[model samples]
Target: MKKKLISMLMIAAMAVSVAACGKSTPSETPSETPSETPSETPAEAKDPSEMTIYFLTKILGNQYWAVVEQGAKDAAKELGIKNLVVTGLASEAEVEKQVQQLQDAVAAQADAIVLGPVDSTAMANPVNDAHASGIPIVIVDTMINTENYDAALMTNNVQAGKDAAKEMIRLLEEKGVKKEEVAEVAIQIGSSGSQTIIDRLKGFYEYWDANAPQTWTVLRDDVKVNDGDISKAVGFTQDFLTAYPNLKGVFGPNNGSTVGFVTGLKEANRTDLVMVGFDFSTEIETMIREGKFNVSTVVQKQYLMGYEGVKQAVELAQGKKPATKLIDTGVLIVDLKNIDNDDVQSIIKPGK
Candidate 1:
């Protein structure tokens, strides 16, 4: 990353620290990480107070995105961005709605746009159009297919998947799950169009294949796609429990899918299955505390995604592109042992 951009983002990055569990990486202090050469260094960019920055999210009213929205709002307030418009579809499935929002941002002559794409491939053209119109784009949480954006900040999801798999292995070993035992693990995801979830799934599989016991396998035949619907996630959880008597573990790569695992496991009154997944929620917290089932989650620095995304946008608005186009905000592994640790608490329930 560029020297100036590093100076701009380091203070906030240092102030927030996310703790890790089960070999997951904690949030790192900003450093001069090497990345692609700077794309553009305009002689002059818009002033923060004169800029109308738009933060477009994947969905609203969801805890994960809600926190992200709050982070953007807080950054806008902190930086004194004159017009910060935060909006998104009510559901992650609304790719067309997000596309329209991007078009509107261009039509409105936005100074910059921070986006969480609903569909990675579908959103690329709209993002490219906005970029073509000279709107600096900073992507958060999810990725678009094109390379037109000014900066991107998100978790290293593939590594996160490997971390989740490692945690799952630990839990299974703790339960005396024999290495040679024929057991099945299932995978659940929210949106097939989301490269974020896709990368997480990829990481998990690659790691599991290389490291897991030969007899243990991911139930690829019945891998469930919830399409961002929590209800469907819950139903899929029930199906996994009912159909696979030898199911020893399951992985939920997003909030809804993980919550579904928690709820469905409880409803079935089954505690024999070890569950590893992503995100933080009350349901997940309660289950961890109850110790009814084995559970651990990979919690992304979502707040940082929004906060840093805006900072990146503001940098671009000021004619200084981020030194690095891609920033891995890192993640924390939260499980029963360290749920109450200060660093973990700060992320799972910030400002509490």
Candidate 2:
């Protein structure tokens, strides 16, 4: 009986040891619970260095284009772009040259292009060709006749013209010149091919016809086509002043024309004539400060147009589309009264 009892106790101890070996130990068990949830992946960032933008202006060596170039450079630096090339013809009438530049940009494998066309219709084919080659183009300052561009950034030119007219009216009133007593007003245009110039003239005419007294006549015959030549503008203004001694106001729809008008007025000692024009320059600023005949100028946001044009082109190159195809950079009327204001100063001397 004692032997059987000892054997039974040994058998129970062996069973207990077997059970302990079959069970998992604390060290063998995992410390973390396996999660059933999935994690979200982040979007990849774009590489700006791979993008190259070409800026083709209507003309170079002008203050307006220079400001635009500076704005584009500022954007390129800020965006870390691989390259920003600015090129254009010497004259605004060089439509064929601009077309060649567009083709060259495509041949160079530019990622995108920003164009201020010399002629709205002449560049349609080249713009379409660029679009066909998968290189996006953004129109700036001026609009092309085609709808193939990725985007167009410009000012409300018609409104800008109306703004100039309104300012002219104000200045005439301040000078104690009654609308009926006013004999004539003359206008100067930079380029007849430029849609921007046409729209401005249209706006100016629309406003003046509706508001001015019936006796006041617009000197349509005296209208001069300067073709961006300041000397032509000056000569035209001198002739107009000599012909229309009763001229109440003069409107220059561009920088060259405005500058020419101011210079001509000074030379002729006819600073008493109210003048309103388009664009901004150091000379225009000085004339305004000196309280000359320059009543005000309708200044477009040219820098913004350039900066935004490049920005949109870069986005297009990166496979992104702009929220809208048309963007108005806006315009402001800068006169002696508001020239020093912060907003006016900002537009007048952009990126300062």
Candidate 3:
């Protein structure tokens, strides 16, 4: 009878947790203020040893995430942030697992959390739980749904998408793609529900629709390809080829799917197509050298993102109010003209 009563109490607590997860409205601006100094230490926070920061990202397998992880670790070292840990989702689709990671971090009495939300809507409950536990949460890379967090560091994904699309349009026009022939472009996205992914797709698609020649109609080949899986994405690309014989341009919002799409191009013997993707991956560098595709991309300032995210979380831990929110961590466009130059190489290199 005693055990049954305890189990009932636990079940009731879990129910309350579900209720807290209810929808949170999206914000045009993050709740916390940004700091001017990219200071070496958590500015005016509590004792360093008492501070702990947990960083969570979307996928674990990619080199991109590896860069973020390195940045977080380095910040902890610089700021003496105790018990600092960085973690990522096992797969892109693992939203629930990612939320659970945040909840567990709070249960461990972490002082603060630096978050990279996979699905913004699904993040409210866990983040609220952390807030209720008196643990500060700082969102980075992507925005979360609630205003209860500290600050966010993000890229202007909409602009990045337009940059990529505009470059592709220029390439097509340069190649003298006649005004009558439509450019059958396809976008193979990494995750369907993520706000970052959605924003990227929206920006690119909107630009392509408005700027491309009147004859060029956007290919509605809406394929959800895994950013982590080389093989599955390659297979999806294979299917796309068989279906769209007139395919012209291809785009991917994340690095893994970009590499996978490139593999598909090589397999189908369609290396002549004008393909543009996000991220300056190793494959992109090699292809640019070989003149394979007029390939170019928008590079995110991920290292700075890593460094600043942890730094801010620590500040929040110390009860220091940040001066800024929506820290637009910057992006740059890479193309054939400058792909081999020092600036481009610097962007592609991580943790520099």
* Clash count per candidate: 2, 0, 5
Model 1: pairs clashing at backbone N, Cα or C within 3 Å: 1-323, 2-323
Per-residue CA lDDT of model 1 for 238-341, tens digit only, reads 89888888999989998888888888989988888888878888888889999878889999989988888898899887778578899998999998899989
Residue-level lDDT for 54 in candidate 1:
94
Query: Clashing pairs in model 3?
Result: 33-322, 33-323, 33-324, 34-323, 34-324
Candidate 3 segments exceeding 4 Å error: 1-44, 350-352
Between candidates 2 and 3, the TM-score winner: 2
CA RMSD of each candidate after superposition: 16.8, 10.8, 16.6
Local accuracy by lDDT, each model: 0.86, 0.83, 0.76
* Better structure of 2 and 3 per lDDT: 2
Best TM-score among the predictions, by candidate number: 1
- TM-score of every candidate: 0.86, 0.85, 0.83
Ranking by lDDT: 1, 2, 3
- Candidate 1 Cα errors over 4 Å, as ranges: 1-45
lDDT of 2 at 295: 73
Candidate 3 local Cα displacement, residue 16, angstroms: 60
